[model samples]
Target chain A: MRRLISMLCLVGVVLFGACALGKVEISGLFMKQAGYQESDIRAMTEEFLKMRPDIDVKLSFVAYEELHDKIVVAAASGAGTYDVILLDCIWPAEFAEAGWLLDVTERLSEEDRADIFPEVLSAVTYRGRLYGMPWLNDWEYFFYNKKMLEAVGAKPPTYWTEVIDIARKLKAQNIVEYPIIDAWGQGEAVVIQWLQYVYAMGGTLFDEAGNPTMNEGKPLEALEFMVQHMDEGLFNPACIESFYEEVRRVFSAGQAAFGLNWTYMYNLANDPAESQIAGDAVIAVIPGFPDGRRSATCNGGMGLSILTSSQHPDEAWDYIQYLASKEVQKKYSQNALPIWKSLYDDPELIAQQPELIKVAKEQIHYIFDRPQVPWYSQLSLILSEELQAALTKAKTPKQAMDDAVSRTKEVMERYAQ
Target chain B: MHSKVPPTPSGMYPRGGLLRRRETAFAWALILPSFVFIGVIIFYPMGLSLRLSLFQVDLTRRGAGTPFVGLANYIDILKSGYFWSSVGRTAYFTVVSIAIEMVLGLFIALLLNEKFRGRSILRSLLLLPWALPITVDAIMWKWIFNANYGAFNALLQQLGLIEKYQPWLTRPWSAMHCVIAADVWKVTPLVALLLLAGLQTIPRELYEAAEVDGAGWFRSLWKITIPLLGPTMTVVLVLRTLDAFRVFDIVYVMTQGGPANATKVISFLTYQEAFKFLHFSRGAALSYLITLIVAVLALLYTRAMKRQIEY
Candidate 1:
């Protein structure tokens, strides 16, 4: 009996030791190309450990498109595999609504709350609750080849009409093959650009009750303007199939005179090896509408959230806070735009990377988020289809908008009660 | 009464009696692990999907419970024009892609059957497309089909075939055809290899006998080659048909069923419904519907296989 007790005690001690040494797994969509290197992550992990040595952090990198799917699968199975997650801004509503994330509103201090941008905060908030911390903030900015603009005897366009006029002039000069390019593929990227144009033209997609009103005249007028640009050859018809990478390639090759893209392209465009006109490229705000209202760019960024099933919420929250801190944000700003407002004004960093600073400041006033809803992903797809149909001449602008509104209403009604 | 009077020794007992029972139990134990694996991995999820399909669950709502709503998901999916259209589109893609692949694959296999110089090298080269990953192939084709800078348009313009670039993946019919072309290019090699294996089993003596009878090449082919190749062709067709029916990766990467869902297949639609739309239950329902159709095909294939075996 004594020997048996000793054997059992030995087993218990071994199990305890195994459990004690286990690492807290935090899954995120970080890639080397996206500027999150393993060495950098390891350095960050060391810093985190110095802050709290009791916690052992294990990071799992997932591809961007696969991240949400992995989280959904893991969360639905009640698996505490992912204690921390990096989510897209639009995903928080669906994830939090699904009870997959821990509500961090009460955990955040008032000062911490004040540090985050309001637009980002609104994106991560659902039903008066915060579910995520903003990490990186992205918005579209206008990019123009300074040399090409000069060669065409034109200046950078500041308004929508000016943009069209410059394209027309460039086309007549035959200086560049494609005058302007934007991501107009049948995906979220195209929908994001379309929304910017629609809002610039003073169109609204939803009413006070959160009901879709895209069939209205204002929205139609906005879509007509977009189609007119395509029809007039200001924008390439090939844009119907072009994605972000394609746009980047065309602009980098100096075949395109002007382009509108997210802030991440700034660094790539500035690289002399990758770009033909690297030093001569300039960044500015997207051209405003004829009515003087500046176009709103769709928000594109990632947020950090803690899973509700996590056994290490406190540790995960610490990591989130660390990522959102001013120091880390400054370091992150060197590669990608950090969401914290303080980093935008950092003189040293701005002086070192003027184009990045220009993009940060110019995009601040025009940043807008997609609809905050659990079904936003689906809604975005529906919007993309309808808009593409109009752009491709498969459906008239009015008919397409009407179809989108009706379909959106149907989906909203299905989810309402 | 006689046996009770004098029970046989244990060793003297018939080996079939006790040993058979033990062997049966041992066999079951060996198979039990595999049975459990299949039940957990395949059947359990399928059963859960079946249950979810009957419920009104979004899985995207916070604290929202899956409420029982029998046949509602099915009714909704059936009622939607989008669902039926995607199904029709998927069927069209499968039939056309499989037919073209089979014909082209058979022709290539026959051509390669002839003894030639660098025959081994040619066989290795044939596998290049099949060896490449589906995503890699899709991306390569996307660039190749690019309207302006693509190799196809460049070649066409060089030959003075057309003055301008064609929007290959933008228009409705052209987009679907372009995807089919890419699909056929990537998978025809696989079908060719399978048919080549079938051709290798054909005896040379039969062709010699046909030659002695003055039967031409086409006559011998029709009389000897095809009849003997029946079982192999059936297997290849069944496998390719099923694979083509579930085609997703190529379309997803290339066009994303784009330009107004012109090339949207059933799998893509289910994926969009589940992951993209967060309508998990609805997506599960659609998946089961697809499974049912595929299962019917599998049953037919099984019957055909049984007939082949009997023959």
Candidate 2:
């Protein structure tokens, strides 16, 4: 019995020593994706591990809707479980303000900073300090069925009014039931989609004093136009509760003539295996109003940030740096539009994803980042519900816009106090 | 299966006083672990939530210290239109769903308790829906309620019940009913099974006696069966009411209070305010209000149940 106990003690000591000598372990939480995108992220992790055998990464992925809440909950607990967190474009302000993220401004070298796009760099900056490394540069693009348009001999619209007119013509000609579908679900998607219209109509959500000014002028007109389309049955009724995936599925199934979706949908809709309208889908820049005002799409991109609670911030930063490197980004740019500006003109990349560079270049020019406010999630909730209320005729467009503005202003005031 | 034994004689417990005290202490010793466990897991969270409700804490706002607002959070929730609307929706959801579940569950339990062919198989089959995860059940129903090409619209179209596929979840009026229907489908089996257990406990001899007394089937059910099942009905109602009042998973997975915030229940609203909006203080206040409501409901249920049990 004594010998047995001694042997067991020796084994335990060896195990403890082995564990102590093991590589540094870091956990990352990211929003879940599918197909090549999911696999591409996995490959990136493997590559990072290969590059630094002294570090091991545990990546956890969740749905997009749950990612924010999970990050907030974990980060609010001060010392969270995750060492690294993938944050949405709008959440950096809230997370940085809460002091949950580590400031990495000094960590990034000048050359590394210069390699990334200025707009993408600005996205990760909070209150003049950089908190995250930009990874995925996402923005909306207009997608239309080539066959559906050709069936009616109609060209893709350059303006919002022409979109409506073409939609009416397509329906009258029995080419398609409705020509437009949007990710107008009562979530962040709706707010983003609605902002496109808001910006297209030459309306601004906030003024010079940072007050919600959506109650009148072009904002109200834009909202009324959206509702009028819904009333006219020119918009897909299902779109009232559909998100990007749903919109992608319906449009790729050739059920709709045109849709407003993110850049990622292009790959899905163009892949013959996943999409029914693989070759039939074509991309275009988002349309503006008939007044020839500049068009805008919500600038949506996710970045990797080290949590303040991370025990191994240096190791996490190493992996993040590897991910944000131009070489890896060039390889994975097809999965998520690369954040680095230099990769856009890479001959090999342009050959691989031809239209991506073209359309993304234009879309990036008119990118409208979500309000850079700390209470953006709450503001989005208020705006989206009010937008839905207007669309559903529960409240008039004017009333809905006015209510949204007042509620947002109230929130701002409460926060100020 | 044996006859009742008579009470022990006085000599059997000459030192009953000391023994009783020791037994009481032993019983407490056995229960002490569970008591502590419950106190930590349940009561501690409740106390913390109550305490937090008195303050103003928004971690999203920079330099926003947790101020001692003392009933101000509750006041703000009361004044907010969103909170009241959510409360109204939750109340409506609870009442309507409980009503539907009780009636359907009772009838199904009655039918299930009968000695019919395939009764055993049918009994096991009824548990399938309840056995599935709520998220799975909700997602399945979401697809069924889909606007473009859902099973419901397809079935209705085939039967010529409607001219076209209708978006059941888009409209406010139909959306609530759709949610209730999904919830009822998922939870009604548990209620039925509970009442079925109650029905099985009923003595066959009492029904035989009623028949000999010239009481019809309905008469015996009304006079004997239901009266004996009073305790069971109260348990079922209380459980169902509490569950329905705090309905979140189904509404969350299905509509997410969508189309126009038509199905935003208090619980989902509180979750949004707390986690999504990062307004933990307000969420706690709303949660406490819900807890108060539930406590009152439980008290009323127990009081009414006591009278029924006595009868």
Candidate 3:
């Protein structure tokens, strides 16, 4: 009886100690790659915990490819395993429609809404409802090898036509066997890369009623451009199986004069340890078609959302707000840029990454989003396969887009019920 | 003679009946744990999955609620062209991989059965591929088949087999074959080891008898070796076919059903249906189809085993 009393007393101590500390523990799920690095996130979490002693946040990371499925499984299980989750821009519609995230529209004040970039805020907004807070601000930018351009005595191309002319000249001079490279592998990467072209050509993927329109518009023309360049040997043949990393590798090795990748590539390509021709790489606004927009890029940003299942949503939101707070965001701006509109003009940030900031400001104006619908995942998968078929020359761009349209129609109809 | 009586239902002498009955009870007690294990781990989930399949359980449509759709999920799956194509792809992968693995396994088993120098070490080393985790094996093969810096391209180029590096996985047809090759490499060792055990069971006297009858090595192999290995060969075939039919991890890691969905097999399709799309009912229904097919194969296996050859 005495021993039992002592054991109960010990348990009592631990219980009371936890209660006395006023601890509210929350866990977050984040992607391991392409945004903030794991160490940076951990450091930021430590700082947040320091600032809010009552709240404890545990974090987990997964590859970006696995993030969507992981989030779905966790949310659908109805287990509050993660109080916070990182959400991609394209997922807001699907997630909001499913009611997996908290309705956070009323959480933001008018001042905060006006302070955040409208384009960046679109990362977390679905149908006028704000589901979360935008955090990672990213988009694709055009990367070029400056020495290769210098070899040909050419300037940065302002339009697709100029890019083609410079590519031809570089090819003729035998400076690089393939003057351009892209990530056209058989996955979401292909769809994003293709959309950049579509948006650059001043085309939208759907009608006002959201019907598919790829068969007769600039989508078809962009695909034709890609295929024609691949055939002409101006674009590398290996890109048919390459992802973003592959594009980075080929470009960093000086095997290609031009490449397209996300903001993460800008730092890595210029890092001497990561690249062979480190100093030769430069970033520019992605080129557009002569008869279309001046520039266009895809929005690759993500947001921080509170799961509906979270027991302590207030604490979760507090943690999220702290992570995206201007102070923390600026401190960790090495990987992803801040989402605040006011931060863009900050002299400190501009001085920290002068070249990247300059190009990013220009690229930010051209950011476009992929289709934001509840069936977007299925749509993206279909687009990836058809785009690959066209890229591999098994189907012409016209037939592939037509088939994609028909297939998307069937999928959309299935979801309509 | 007067003490003689009609036989009991058990047909046992009355004296030992109790003991035998106790032995039977003890036997059940020994296997009770396994029965409970199977009941909890296998049957419970299977029952739940069956219930799930008869309804429309899409989490993406949360407020709509899961409605009983009966066999609609199955019907829709059967009607889909993607499902049919995935089935065809799975069939191709299963047949081709099993064929290659069986042939290679039997040859290696024959070679291992021979008494030669360093044979023990070779046998031990042969188990390495089988012992490796499937993901590791798949990743290794992906690197080997990489387009830009793959060892395959380098070797082929040095051998003058091709003028330029070939994209082994970028093309649809080649991608499927590459996945099959990875599966074959990972599974052949277990098949060989099983066949080796079967080889060891055959008596040396039969080979001597064949030799006395003036049978050549080829003749003996065709008649003595293969005939005696029938049961083991059948076992290998059933095990490999069931395994190859549901191939998932290797294909997932290597190709991701890519290059125009060339390597997209049925299991990968089921994964996309359930997990990626959040359509649990359709996923459950697709899994039920696989279970049905596997059940048929298992029945055939049990029946074949019952007619096993005995010396």
Candidate 4:
């Protein structure tokens, strides 16, 4: 019995020592939809695991809609639920303000900072402090069925005016019921699309003195333009109920001559298995107003962030660095563009999707951000509801903008207090 | 199957003895776990939310201290246009759906109560809609009402009722009605089952006596059936009203309170305030208001139920 007891004690010590040298387990939260596909992420993780067998990663996914609230809840509880999380560009202000994200400004080297696009880096920065590494690089691009444009004997449009003329011809000839389709749904999608128009029109939501400028100038004009075009049946009425997925489906169905969506749509739109107008679908720069500015696109990049409450912050940061590394990102450039500006010049990288890389080079130059505020969610809600009111004719464009202007001013003032 | 056992003596369970004490102690021991469970599961959150609501707890405001600004959150909610409009929408959903459901449920229950062929199979089949999960039911209805390729539009088109497919969920007014329709469709079956149970309890002799005295079917329905079914109807209304007034899942799956916030019910608003915006105190206050509204509604209904109709 004494010998058996000593042998058991020896076994217990061995097991504990083995455990001390075992894998460091960390979990990451990623959205199942858009940007990097699930299979791509799993493959990336598998590769990462092969390289670092001493570290174990557990990945979980939620829909994009649930990602924000899920992060907020997990962070608020201080539960260390996730070590790494996918961060939307619009969320950094709110998350950083809540102190839910790790401050990693000093971790980025000068060489690393210089290689990445400044606009891409801004997605992960709040108040000049870097919080994460930019991973998915996405922006809206104009898509058109080449056949429909050819049927109307029109060339590819460079200006909003030229697009309008082509859309008019397409409508008059009965080539399509609606020449243009967009996602103007009642959420962040609506605000992003609307802001793209506002940016294209050379409009700012605030003046130099930080006064609200939504009720006048091009912001008001943008809303009026949408209401008028929708009434003329140029914009699809169904867009009011559509999100990005719906926009992709509608554009792929050959029901619309023109549409705007993020990078994922380009591949899906041309896939023979997914689309009816597979080969004819072409991507170009989203048009801008000739009188106002050059091409404008809404920045839709997301980032790899380490949660402040993560127990294994070093392991999480290592995983994020691996995911956002130039080589890994360049290899997985099927769904999205790489954030590194140098990759755009790489022969093999450009060879994968030459047309997209060519347009993305110019499009990235014109990328504009959504308003980065801590109360952005509230501001987004106000924008979505007011924009819908104008679209649905519940209020005139002027009235809707006026209400939005006042509410925006009030929210800013509250924050200022 | 065997010989009968004798009855226990009257003193077997003496009220004032040591065995009684031991039995009492055992009963208390068995009940203690559930009592603690109720306190933890139900009362703990209630207390936490109540405490949180009294303070200004906006997480997004970073270092802003959570001050005890009692009743300020409630006042702000009452003053907000969003809250009042959401309340109006919730009321519209509850009243319109319950009115239609009660009438339709009673009519279906009356028909099912009659002698018929394949009655047993029909009765069992009636439960399918009620048995479906709300998420699945809402998703099914969302597809059925899809603007581009929906079964409803196809049916309407085939019948020459319209020239083109209508955007049913795109419009604010129509979207609310579509949501109410989805809720009503899933719930009316359960309502019918409840009414059918009440129908079974009605004595057929009352109808026979009335018929002998020259009363017709409509008269018997109006004079006898309706009044006796009052208690069951009251119970159904209370359940349906509470459920409809706090609707979130169907609206969430279908419209998500879209197209100018037309279908934004109170619970959806509360969710947006708390989680989406991270204004915990405001959300807590909004949820407490919901609790108060439901409690008051249930009380009024039970009061009506208590004043039972006399024959």
Number of the top lDDT candidate: 4
- lDDT of all predictions, in order shown? 0.81, 0.86, 0.89, 0.90
Query: By lDDT, is 2 or 4 better?
Result: 4
Output the worst ten-in-a-row residue range by lDDT, candidate 3 chain A. A237-246
TM, every model: 0.91, 0.94, 0.92, 0.94
Model 4 per-residue lDDT at A113: 92
Q: Which stretches of candidate 2 lie over 4 Å from their true place?
A: A1-21, A33-36, B1-29, B209-219
Q: Write the per-residue lDDT of candidate 3 for residues A312-362, one digit (tens) a residue.
A: 999999999999999998988888889888987999988898998888888
Give the winner by DockQ: 2
Q: Which portions of model 4 miss their true places by more than 4 Å?
A: A1-23, B1-10, B210-214, B309-311
DockQ for every model comes to 0.60, 0.76, 0.57, 0.69
RMSD of candidates 1 onward, in order = 4.7, 3.3, 4.2, 4.2
DockQ of candidate 4 is 0.69
lDDT of 4 at B60: 88
> Model 1, A99-175: lDDT tens per residue?
88898888888987886778777767778888888776667788888987887678777788888888888888888
What value does the lDDT take at residue B25 in candidate 2? Answer: 77
Interface RMSD of 2: 1.0
